[model samples]
Target: MALEDVPRLGCGRSIDEVWAGIDQPPTGHEEHCQYCQTARTRLQRLQEATVALRESDLHDPELKPRPGLTRAIMDVARAEVRRGNRLLVRTTDHGTIEISEQALDSLIRIAATAIPGIHSRRCRIDIRTLPNSPHETTSTARAPRLVINFRVAAAAGIDIPKTVDALRQKIRTAIPAGIGIDAGTINITVEDLYDV
Candidate 1:
């Protein structure tokens, strides 16, 4: 079953809601609800494992993560943060300029937030270089392309379709010229719903 459709307890509480209230004394539903019981068992095991892991990390130097692991992880993270999202913009006065993916993400976030009922949570911009098919032996000109994906948490009781269309319009207008993506390809997903 989907998470939203999971059977709640008699008190209309889900496993997650109860999990959040972990510090509180257990209620009748928590004891009787099969979902809650199962969740509690899993959580208890996880808690034990976490304690064990931390203790081992403190006491056993051999069990610790390898040296340079932090540097390696940071390197990969920096590479990901720097790569594939730069937008080549056509500038009239100053020739050509490249806008970083981070800038594009910020632009998307701003545009999305301008829509009354939607707030952007995250924005990702992907710029790809077109590759030639295997059948074509001769090399083709590398044409750059762009795709935008954004997730939003929207207020309840709004028309989602209309919201998406308006969001698309806003992004199209805000994007600087020369990012080769058509408006139709810019994707928007309302990944969450919240009460305001």
Candidate 2:
């Protein structure tokens, strides 16, 4: 289901709303409602994880993420409160491992910025799930194929085709290496140019 289509808790509050008010004092309904309390607790954990991840990334000198990357990471973290559109990474007898779409977007942005002369603008990920073989077991279920639509700005005087090819190759390799998920079709658009 789409993020917006995801159902609200019994208290009628979306997780997004809860996250927005995470720092505020709890309302009477929130204090008494079990669903609201649970959502708040879980969201707080997610908030902590986001902060930790940001700190680690910032301290890693080799990463050198683009300017405003921290803000972008927080924005994605906030949007992830809706918790929809997760891609399956693997399946086992124990359970399935999934990664959020926003996390993948952040990974893509970071990967794109690693290529010199390329700056990521925006990206969207779509997934197409192929039918499983009739004999295949649940533990070995196939993951949905990922199709990425990425927009970027290139440094002036850069060879557009060559640099973009490098960008594509970077994304293709990075996704699998970073998250253990294979990237499928990648459509890149050089939407703007920036001075180097």
lDDT of 1 by residue, 1-196 (tens): 6777975655577766776766666678777777777777776778778989888889997877999999999999988887755665433344556778787777677777789889888777776656556554332233446677888888899998998899888888776443444433587889999898
Give the Å shift of residue 21 in candidate 2. 52
Error of 2 at 113 (Å): 1.6
Cand. 1 TM to true fold = 0.45
Clashes of each: 0, 0
Assess candidate 1 and give its lDDT: 0.73
lDDT of 2 by residue, 6-86 (tens): 669987888788888998988888999999999999989999999999999989887886889999999998886767678
TM-score of each: 0.45, 0.55
Candidate 1: Cα lDDT at 113? 76
Q: Model 1, which residues run further than 4 Å from truth?
A: 1-96, 131-143, 177-184
Kindly give the stretch of ten consecutive residues in candidate 1 with the minimal lDDT sum.
135-144
Off by over 4 Å in 2: 1-84, 133-135, 139-141
